[model samples]
Target: MAPEAEPRQPPVDPRLWRYAAASRSFFLVIALLSLAQTAAIVGFAFFTTRAIVDAIAGDDLTGTLAALTGVVVARALLSLVRERVAARASARVESQLRGAVLDGIARLGPGWTATRSTSHLALVAGRGLDALEPYVGRYLPQLVQTVIATPLLIAAMWQADAISGLTVLLTLPLIPIFMILIGLATRSVQRRQWETLSRLATRFSETVQGLSTLTVFGRQRRAADAIERVTDDYRRETMTVLRVSFLSGFALEFLASISVAIVAVAVGFRLIDGSLTLSVGLFVLLLAPEAFLPIRQVGVQFHASSEGVAATRDVFAVLDAAAAASAPPAQAAAPAQGADHRLRLEGVRVRDLPPVDLEARSGEIVLVEGPSGAGKSSLLQALLGFASATGRIEFDGADAASRPPSTWLAWAGQRPGLASGTIAANISLGDDDMPAETIQQALALVGLADVDPYRMLGVQGAGLSGGQAQRVAVARALARHLRGHAPVLALDEPSAALDAAAEQHLWQSLRTVADAGALILLVSHRESARTIADRVVRLNSAEVTA
Candidate 1:
């Protein structure tokens, strides 16, 4: 296969300001700090040169040494302050970007995330953004220093000695030229390493998630070998990035050292011939290296932060997608929110499925029944805004697509979808207050009352049996409606894992909830569901019926 194409990105993405407001303030603070730091560099160089020359000439040295000491202390203090500021800014930017990425994912909906790798997404939000510390704390500050200090230091040197300044001005461009040439190679290798790491994480996650199935088919060893191969690829790419970084660092150091040496030779020759004063020559010599220091460090920091730069591109892509998705349609007016219990669908067609229409009001149980491949699940998904459909769906006369499902609908899918937490926490998911009475009522409604509310569960509700986990999921959905968070409940195959008695009990409890004034849309293949359902919506490949 041909190599993956490297994505071109700017040194500093403009989107950081838009998505992470902290970055805007960070830039302003960094600009102010860079100005102070530039002044400190000039002061320190001037004072140190003054102190050295005064001692050589047998002049009074006390005042010059004191001034030099003060300048040294100020420079160190400035550096400490800059380090602290960079650290704080790095943390704030990381947090802000991570939040925006998660919110963007929510805005894009499950349909979008379902198409992307969960492992890669986790990496981006977790370790990927965490890498921004070096980028923000070190690389960015050095960049600001280079922009501010390099020119001014050169100007100071020119005022002291013209020849040294001119030499530096001419040769300063060489470091960046070499940096640009080497940076291109560094970015390519670093991006490849980043992509390889993502692939390795994804492969390992998939292997662990399906290890049981792999072992059943005697393919576990093959899976392990595949993971190892991807790991090796990551290791090789990382070594390549390291090699390029080392070569670039050496090239920059060599160029800067050569340029400074030429300035030193000229200064020494001019002084020996009595054409230059010791004070002036010494001052220019000191400032010459300071002029080149910021730019050289910029190159080194760029290599150190290349991984973070690559990750930020991934973050920006997600933020851009969310921005695009959130842009409201020009002709469509905003939906006004109000109290209305009626659920309505008009010509709602999902994928290749035929258009569907239905209406139900409060205190009604609508059972959606169909054979396999009949689009029953897709219908629920379209209503819940998890799937795209071409038609109008309104709840209480407000467009369903315009609002999040949690605002008006509570839902449970075939999977339990539980995280590691207590049973009460699972039932009251999203409820900050965790009302105990409501938790007890919901558990009783779903016949999980005997299950302790405070009992802890493992990942994916591991402690509960399949049927118990399914019932707990049902209770959680019911609890949302009971707690007045949503007015409707959408359940898909909640009884698929239950025995006949439990299934029948679940249908009766659902009927009780419906009688108490909450609308319910249930998808089930069980015939017993129809007995309690006030209305039945039967679906087939060709059409839908009520």
Candidate 2:
């Protein structure tokens, strides 16, 4: 099958203005600066032409020379101001867009992210958005200058001498036409370069994550070769983009130089025939290049900022998807108040899974039991609002979607989700000012009383063994419940890595919490879990039975 074509994108994306307020302000500032710069260009050219003609006529030239010098200085100052504004705008707009992308991802939830590549998202958020600096700084200002200055300068030239103005009007369209052709080629190679970079990131992340497995299977060399191949491809793609950029720059310069030369030739002949005065001829000759400057620079800068353009396209896709997903906005389920938290799921279905109906209130131990292929984990995900499903889920008589799960639910998944932090910090991840006593109690409940709470850990709890990490995760969930921060605790195979004694101890600890009025939702395949459960909810082939 042929590869799908990329979508056509506009030069200035409207979404940037909608999502980032800074872009709108930047445009306003740039327009004002562009107007001042245009005035300076006209004044400088007129004064310089006047100075030359006056000198030939042997007129005193102090005033014209002074005015010309001032215009030159003003022009330089304006350029500096434009640069500062563009730099600030680039930083602000990049920050705004990055924040919006992150918020969009949050609104889309974990299920949306699970289907996408994490490395690709990281690229978009990190390096991809950073590429926007040149686009916002140099390209956008030049584009705005072209819009504001080009026509005004052309009119000035026309007022001075119509033949030169007419010649410029005819030739300016050619630059854009050439630019369009070159841009098509440039975008193709830049896109390949971007995709190859994403692939390299994904490959490296995968390799690092599974390095041991690859080594055991004797596939490490092959994985390294694959990464090398992608790197080479990326390097080639980059070279191709650079080649196109240089060629386009040369083409634009050549066109602009030729157009100005034509205007100069016409002005020279008119000056000789005495149809145009010396002042008029010189003024038009000078303004001719000024008229073409902005447009040519715009063409050049467009190639420079092409990477940012591609990145913005990806950013906008995420923002658009999130907007579509949350049309009219989502009112999460209200938190259950003052004890008596009740979770009710009515015909709740996750993906293609069969509907699940369950009602559990505070102080109950509800165990989720099922075979391997059953939607046991999916059901927990539904309650956590990570997965999309068609169903009515309520907590304390309010729509469950109206509130976040963190307000009422504490969960420990199969993976510990530990970061590089002290044990106390990991256990009380979301809670603030957790007492040392409380952390100690939580550790003891999970059979880790001997472990020091203040001891630091490496990435992903690297200092701990498998069973220790699992118990630490459980303690984290239990710590939240113990602090009364959440009324319900959800653990998926909390004791999977624990030995029999540790497993039994963890179950007894859970029973004690439930007896003290905390609702527990446990998913386990082991038979020992049945001893402490108040109810067993079995799932098989997506269907749930109590």
Candidate 3:
């Protein structure tokens, strides 16, 4: 049967309404503050012009000065309030977005994330989200105020004089129309540039990670040259985006300026003909630019928002990938306890590979003996639910494939995966509550007691020998053993890096673990590993028998 589809996520483009809805109260407050500020500024200009005209007309100076002073004070206070509210709202949105993205990644799990590049993911979480800052703080508030205040301001202007208001209204739409056309033209280019940037980041991360290998092969110069070429491509793409952005800005500015100029000319003619008063003409002149201000600002902000939009697309692409189908819910019944919880692999076949049959009884050792490429490693991975395998894997009469295998199995691979932290932290792997004494005991059991528990291991277990690294991996497995239930242990080439005595002790440790009723399954190329196994299963191209 074909695999079932994974759950679908929302569309790639982030919905602005969703962001507004998430922090509605903050947005509402910001909207009110922005309108208040716009009104105060617009009101200040109107009052100032009125006051100057009154002074020229030999009217009361004291009243005019007091009115202008109040306008200035109110404008300042409203501007400050707008700034404060916007900062808080932007911070809240950024926090929520970061957490949501991380949670989404977590739900997708290692199986999905393993295929993606760390650098690309980093860019999405870091730079991509950073782009949203202005959208939340500045553009969004401006958009809200423009929607609310622009109409009111225009209506007031109409009350002052119908012709001037009409002039402003007709010119307003032209700015946005020009901006939209320019945006549509550049949208595809912006998307391509973001892809190129992500590719560059991924390649740079890979090159840095493999710097040691390149140096060893005497190909560092070639790697540097390759990086330079990619960077040059990235630079060219960035310049294209910059050029388009500048052109868009210039276009919007020119349109707004022309629109304001038209309103100015028409108002000037009215004033000259005595059809409009000085106060009304000044008000219309000030409000004319204000009408086109939001549209022009939006044009500029959209360019900034494009980076985030592109990044969000990449983020959604990862979240939208179909994950491997999980086992059927009906097959997830709990396995029987004690001796019945053993693993049985019956005719387990992997694709383009051989079939192998094996079983491990409780408190027993099942040695998987084979040379390199004998499918021993692949078999272990299949058992751990990392690879798809055909046939049945029964756990105490329950199908192993039906439930999570990690609940009962502990796997130790050849390469010991360690982060840059203390030895105890590495073994516990973020289990902060794990006792230090328990960590020491596990290390001692794996013959790695010499290494300090609090000592820092460099990135990727650097400075450790092959055998020491293997021992650390073994120690990690033992630390897991310290937890309540003794899970089934499966090690691939556990003795490959140990000395004769250490290898003997490691086998003894496995035997000890097995004696405690835990199924111990190990893969080994050494003949000596057979001495510790209760039953040895040999696998070849198409044969598996005891």
Candidate 4:
């Protein structure tokens, strides 16, 4: 079957402007700076021509030279200001865009990001958004410069030489006309480039992550060849984009050059015929290129920012969906008077998991044990709201859906996430405000006291033993429980990666948490795990046993 087509995307999303903060002050600064720049450009031309004419007329040029020097200095300073402001605005825009993309991903949850490949998302957030630098820093400022300075420069030219001004006015429209025509083709190429890059990144990421399995199967060469094919395709798309950019730039340059030559020739003839002064002819000649400079730059910058424009569509699509699906504000629930904690699952079935009807209480551990392939993982996911199911989960007799997933439970997954950071930071997941003692206390409760509070662990616990990583996961859960925030604790195969001794130690830690008035829902088949349970629930097909 043929693959489905991707939906069409706009050239750029206007909503991105919302994140940029490049609105009122940004535009005002551009306008003011461009006005100053226009004046400097015109004055530089006037003074430069005046100095040259003074020298040719055999007149003393000390004053003309001084005037020219001052104008040059002013023009340079004004140019500097324009460029600096543009760079700052671009930086602010890129920073804001990146933050928005990451925040949206977090809020959207893995359910959303899992559908998009990790490498594609990473590229979008990192290198993809960097393309906006040229868009904002160079293209946008040039656009504004054209709007503000172009007319003023043309008017200055008309005051000096009417025929040359007429020539500029007639040809000015041609640059944009061709730009629009080629820009249509350029956008199409950019879209293909973005798609190819995404495919290439996805292939590379998948190949790298599965290299071990591929090697075991002796198919690593096949995977390598596939990645190389995608990379070569990406290379070709990139070259196509560059070719368009170069061609458009060359065309704009050639057109502007022709226009300037016409004006220069007319001025030179008139200068010899005594119909125009040399100073005025020189001034008109200088202003001619400035009139076309903005449009010329617009052509060049479009390609530089094209990737970012394409990436924005993806970013906004994710953010828009996340916004639409934005979880409603959780209503605060008052706990039942006399209940320590209560978790009730009424006819809950997730994926292929058998339907479950269960009730759990705090201050005790409830172990769900069965042979593998009983959908224990799916059942846990349903309870955590990570998977879809048909029944109601209640906490303290309130609908579980009424509360955000983060509100009621502290979780320790089958494989927990660990960052490369200090032990305390890892426990808090980089929330620096979480106290050091809080982390140490949690680690102590999970039988990880010997693990230094200040010690740094690599991502996925590269610095720590498998047992230690498992303990860190437990410590993370315990920290939340100790904070008196979450009432129920859900741990899925927490010791699956540990040895017998480590597994027993892990169960002892969980038993302590359960004894301390937090409800524990553990999935395990180990005899040691069952010994710590206040109640062991077994699943056989669709039946539940105690």
Q: If ranked by lDDT, best first, what sequence of candidates would result?
A: 2, 1, 4, 3
Candidate 1 local lDDT, 1-546, one digit each (tens): 997776677778888889878888888888888888888888888888888877878899898888888888888988999999999999999999999999999888886787789999999999899999999989998998899889989998888888888999999999989988999989888888999999999999999999999999999999999999999999999999999999999999999999999999999999999999988988898888899999999999999999998898888888988887666445334322223388999999988998889999888999999999899889888877678789899877767665566767889998999989899989888787968999999989888878899999999999999999999999999988887777888999999999998998899899988887888999999988989999999999888889
lDDT of each model, Cα atoms only? 0.88, 0.90, 0.75, 0.80
Tens-digit per-residue lDDT, 1-546, candidate 2:
999988887779899899889999899999999999999999999999999999999999999999999999999999999999999999999999999999988887897788788999999999999999999999989999999999999999988888888999999999999989998898888988888889999999999999999999999999999999999998998999899999999999999999999999888888789898899988998899999999999988999898998788788889988777665324343334337788898998888877889999888999999888688888889888787788898877777665566777889999999999899999989777888899999999999999999999999999999999999999999888877778889999998999999999999999999988888999999999999999999998846899
User: Taking the candidates one at a time, how many backbone clashes does each contain?
Assistant: 0, 7, 0, 0
TM-score of every candidate: 0.75, 0.74, 0.67, 0.71
Q: What TM-score does prediction 4 earn?
A: 0.71
Top lDDT hit: 2
Candidate 2 vs 4: which has more lDDT: 2
Models ranked on TM-score: 1, 2, 4, 3
How accurate locally is residue 40 in candidate 1, as Cα lDDT from 0 to 100? Answer: 83
Instruction: Give per-residue lDDT, candidate 1, residue 233.
Output: 99
Clash-forming residue pairs, model 2:
331-402, 332-401, 332-402, 332-403, 333-401, 333-402, 333-403
| Model 1 vs. true fold: TM | 0.75
